[model samples]
Target: MLVLGIVLFALGLMFSIAWHELGHFLAARRFGVRVPEFMVGFGPTIFSRQRGETSFGIKAVPLGGYIRMIGMIPPAPGQRIGRSRRSGPFQGLIDDVRADSVKDFRPGDEDRQFWTRKPWQRIVVMFAGPFMNLILAAVLFLIVLVGFGIPTAQPVVQSVSKCVVPASQATTTTDCPPGAPPTPAAQAGFQAGDRIVSFDGRSYDSWEDMQLAIRASSGTVPVVVERPEPNGAARTLTLYPQLIETQLLDLDAARTSGEPRYVSGSFLGLSPIQPVTRQTPEQVAGYVGEMAQRAVTSILALPSKVPALFGAVFLGEQRDVNGPVSVVGVSVLGGEVLASNNAVASEIATMLQLLAAVNVSLFLLNLLPILPLDGGHILPALWEGAKKRIARLRGRPDPGPVDMAKLMPIAYGFAIVIMLYGGLVILADIVNPIKLNL
Candidate 1:
């Protein structure tokens, strides 16, 4: 099952890559840009077949993919066909870049070249790929949040803690020390499966409301719960649960840390039941919006996590679960999700969430305004548009397209850095993979 899940995930990734490239391919064709090839993955071609003006194929490496559009970069001014000259050290590299940019030149393709299109059209062609990823992410998020339902914290108790541990020494293990005090929940005879109905004469439907009430209480509070009897009758139980000052899990700061930060709060040792509940369309949209914000924030914080990533790999420190991951790591997680003892529904929901996350990452990663990315290409188009507008305003001749070949050095450097980062992440993933407790 795990192997099957990994294979399925790999296939999904391939589909995503192909879908992204297809967006660019279609948009380029729409804008009259001649596309020579539409390939998924990179490196040496595994198999290829020419259809019409385009060659379609997969490649040896599945790291990334692209569609080869004719004349992505504009030629140097005063440059002619079949001309080859190297001015200086870096000039040869620039010349090679500009030359290869138009190597697919056909007789009639001169006018259909990408650089010949309007700035808006070029922008649309470059933006289409990332837009496809965003669309996929939104669709998947809706499926998981509305169709399968989202896992929600309910006012039902799943378990009661056995003892109260000091905030400074708190751990996940429930093994109590000798002579440790009993938790308020245990002392009040709070058992598993009890549904919290009210606290301090206040009725609450959600666990969050009940939790706040507990945290704000400084003394014993009137607690009303609906407990199910073995005979199937529901009986009301009222116990003054003396709220104790103990360590509470800081939910906001606990995401990236292995050990949750403990803060003093009125502790009720009952764990809320996480029930899968469907959300409305508006609710799902809000959820996706929040996720998109978080995704953007994570991408921005990625560079800062490099040191931690290295420390975790070389210094034997625990790796943060929210740290960067390569495709290998994601595939391993998919396998782990399938191999877990969770129900089929739970597993499917988890995998769907994972896929949505992958799509979101894809969208954000490609949107980085650096060379070789979709956003990178969009930048030049925008600049050209601005330049043309300014030219018209000054009543001068319109300038040609931005010479993207000039940015090749920086693009090459950025590409190398990205490759190195990916290599490090892949190595870290293999050495210290995140173990998810389902």
Candidate 2:
């Protein structure tokens, strides 16, 4: 089962890579850019087939993918293709990149080159890859939220606490401390599986409403619960339980600070059962929006986590559960999820959510505006367009497309950093994997 889960996740990852590259391929084709190859993964081609002018294929390494479009970098001003007189290390690197950019150049294919396209067209082609990932993430989130549902706390009682414990002294253990006061619900004979029908003489539709009512009330109150009988029948019972003031979470303050905040409220000591509940489209949209924001924040914090990642890999430090993970780590997590003794729907939903998160991460990471990223290409194109616009407004000669060849050295450097960081993450994943608490 573990191997099967890993294989399934690996296939999903490959499909996501292909989907991302497909966006670039389709957008490039739309703008008349000659894409000679559209392949998933990297390294030696494992399978390929020619379709029209494009050779679509899969490669040995399922790490990343790309679409090869002709003339990615414009030639140096007043210089012919494949010709460079500059003699320096950076110049040599730039020249090499320029040469590869036009390696597939053919007669009468000048207009089909990617650099010849308008700035907006070029931007569309480059941005399409990340946009596809965002779309996939949203769709997967919708499927999981609407189809499989999300775990929600219901009004049904899962357990009843024996004694009152203050919110500030919260602990995992349910054991009552010596001389602790007995909870109202326990005194009222509340049992697990009892569904709260009404509280304080008021019928509530949701757990939140019941909680608010409980907090607002004081002294002995009539609480109604529908308890199941031995004959599969349910009977309503009204029990007078004295509500006591205790510390409870302040949801509004917690939302602002992203940390627990507490205030005094009436305590009943009833723990709600969590059941899977389907959500509306609006709810799903809000959920995905929040997920995207968190993903962006995580990407921004990635650099700070590298030292800790190395510690986990080399110093035998504990791996942070919320820390960065590589593709290999995610696959292992999927395997653990599948091999666990969980319900089938729950496992499937968890896997889909994991894939959605991966897509969200891909969507944000590719938009970092660093060299070799989609945003890197996009920024230059926008600058070129702005320069042309400014030149026309000032009655000056139009500036040609930005010279991307000049940025090749920086791009190469960034690529190296990315590779090293990825390697470190992989090593950490292998040595000190973050296991699921389940």
Candidate 3:
């Protein structure tokens, strides 16, 4: 099962990379830019085929993919292709990049180059890749939320505690201790599988609202519950149980920090049953929004996590559960999920969610305004557009396309850093991988 899960995830990753490149290919073609190659993965070609003007192929490595568009870096202003008069330490690098950008140039293809397209068209071509990832993530999220459903706490009681255990004394055991007072739910004859109907004369639909009402009640309240009979019918029961204030953990504080903060509140001993509940489209949208926010936060915090990743890789340190993960790590997690003893539906849902998260991460990470990234291309296109607009407004000649060759040095440096970070993450993933609780 583990091997199967890993294979499945790897295949999904390849498909995702292909889909992303397809976005760029389609958009580039839409704007009449010449795309010579549409390939998934990096390294030497494993399989390739020429289709019309494009050569489609798979590569040796399955980590990333790309589409080669003509004139990605425009020639120097008023200069011939592959010619540079500038002399500097980075000049050779810039010239090499410029030379490669048009190495496959053919006759009468000047207008078909990517740099010849309007700024908005270039932006569309660049942004289309990441946009495909966003679309795939949303679709996956919808399938998981609407088809399989999400685990939600229902209003039905799963268990009823015999005694009221204060937050301070509640460490592990939930069994009744000596001299502990009986809980309000126990006194009111609450049982497992009973569905809460109303609390204090007001009807309740969700467990959360009923919990808030239970916490706010001061005196004896009319608690109504529908308990199932042995004959398969449910009978309504109303019982008046005096509410007592007790020490309880402050939920907000506990959620913010993994520390217990106790406060006096009305105590109820019922534990709600968790069941899979299908979500509406609005709820799914909200869930996806929250996930996207977390992905952004994770991307922003990547720098701070490098030290921990380094330690985990070289110093034999324990891996942080919430730390960064590489492709290897994600695959291992998928394996673990499948190998677990969870229900089949649960395992499938978890796998879908994991893939969805991967897509979301890809969508956001590629949008960073750094060279070689989709956003890097997008930023230059936007600047070129702005420059053209300003030149027109000032009655001056067009400033022309942004000099992408000059930015190659910075892009090279960023690429090196990315390689190092990716290497560290991959090493850590192999050595000290995060494991699922299941």
Candidate 4:
């Protein structure tokens, strides 16, 4: 099951990457740019087939993918194709970039260049890739939230404990330890499937509210539970719950693999009924919005988290599950989801949600206004458009497109920073994986 999950997840990520490239390929073609190669993954091509002008293929590495558009950067002034220029400290880098931009160039293809397109068209071409990822995320969220639904604990008794056990020592086993006293729920004849209607003669709505009422009580509390009878009638039992000073498990932390923490509180030893509830369209939209906001927050907090990630790996500190995860980490988590003892529906939902979150991350990360990223191209396009507008308003001659080659050095610097950070994250993921409970 773990192997199957990893394979499936890997395949899903490949498709997502391919889908992202397709957006760029189609949009570039739409704007008359010659896209020579549209490939998913980087490094040596594993399998490639030429269709019309473009060669489509997958590479060995599954980390990232791209669509190679012709003439992404404009040529240097008076610099001819296949001609060498005078070398400076950064001249080699500039010449290399320019050469690569027109590498697949053929005669009479000058008019089909990427830089020749309108600024708005260029922006659209660049933005389309990330936009595809966003669409996929929304679709996945819909399938999980509205189609399959989500489970939530309700204010109803699913099971009643036979005996009182320490919260830290509780397990699925029904064997009550020697000398363990019977719980208040068991002594009061509380059974499974009992709907907790009210506590102390007051009707309650949510399970959390009932939990608070139970914890606030000390001695005996008048609890009203509706139990279904064999004769198709419901009987209300007034159970005098002799509350005990027991340790209550922290429900929030119980969802993870960390040792459960216990707090001293009044106990009843009744478990809430968990039911799968379908969300409305509005609710699902809200969920998607919330996820988008969280993605933005995570992206913004990435710089702040670098020190902590380093500390966790080097200083032997606790790993933060909420910290960044690489492709390897995500694939491992996917395998864990399938290997877990959770229900089949739950596993499927979790995997789908994971894929959705990945897509969301891709969408948000690509929007950063740095070179090599889609947003980098977008910023230049917007700036060029603004300059053209301002020139026309002042009745000056057309300034033409902004020279994007000048930003290559800065782009290279940003690329190095990105690679370094990604390396650190990858190392952390391998050395100390963030093991999640769910």
lDDT of each: 0.82, 0.86, 0.86, 0.84
lDDT of 2 at 166: 77
Q: Taking the tens digit of each residue's C-alpha lDDT, what string does model 4 give over 135-213? A: 9999999999898898777988899888888766777689999998888788888888888777877888888888888
- What are the per-residue Cα lDDT tens digits for candidate 2 across 327-406? 99999898888888999989999988999999999988998898899999999999999999999999999789999999
TM-score of each: 0.89, 0.83, 0.83, 0.79
Q: Taking the tens digit of each residue's C-alpha lDDT, what string does model 3 give over 1-438?
A: 999999898888888888888899999999998999999989999999999999999999999999999989999888989758889999999999999999989997899999999999999999999999999999999999999998898889999888877666775577678998887778878789887777777888788787777777776677667777666454445444444545443333342344445656677788999899899888988998988987887787788789899899889998977788998899989989999999999999999999999999999999999988999999999999999999999999999999999999999999999999998999999989999988
Model 1 residue runs over 4 Å out of place are: 81-89, 166-172, 209-220, 230-262
Cα shift from native, residue 57, model 1 (Å): 0.7
Each prediction's number of clashing residue pairs = 0, 0, 0, 0
Of the two candidates 1 and 3, the one with more favorable TM-score, higher being better, is 1
How would you order the candidates by TM-score, starting with the best? 1, 3, 2, 4
C-alpha RMSD by candidate, in order: 3.2, 4.6, 4.6, 5.5
- Compared to the true structure, candidate 4 yields what TM-score? 0.79
In candidate 4, the residue pairs with backbone N, CA or C atoms under 3 Å apart (3 or more residues apart, or in different chains) clash, namely: none
TM-score for candidate 3, please give it: 0.83
lDDT minimum window of 10 residues, candidate 4:
249-258
lDDT of 3 at 199: 73
User: What's the lDDT for candidate 3?
Assistant: 0.86
lDDT tens readout by residue for model 1, 1-438: 889888778787888888888889999999889999999889999999999999999999998899999988888777774445746657777878888988989799889888889999999998899889888878888888888897789988899988877667677676998887788788888888887767777888888777877877766576777777665444445444554445544432344444455645677678998988988888877887877877876787678779988987898789877788889889888888888898888888888788888888898899888988898999889999999999999999989889898899889899999998899899889998887877
Q: Relative to the unseen true structure, what is the Cα RMSD of model 2?
A: 4.6
Off by over 4 Å in 2: 161-190, 194-270
Measured by TM-score, the strongest candidate is 1
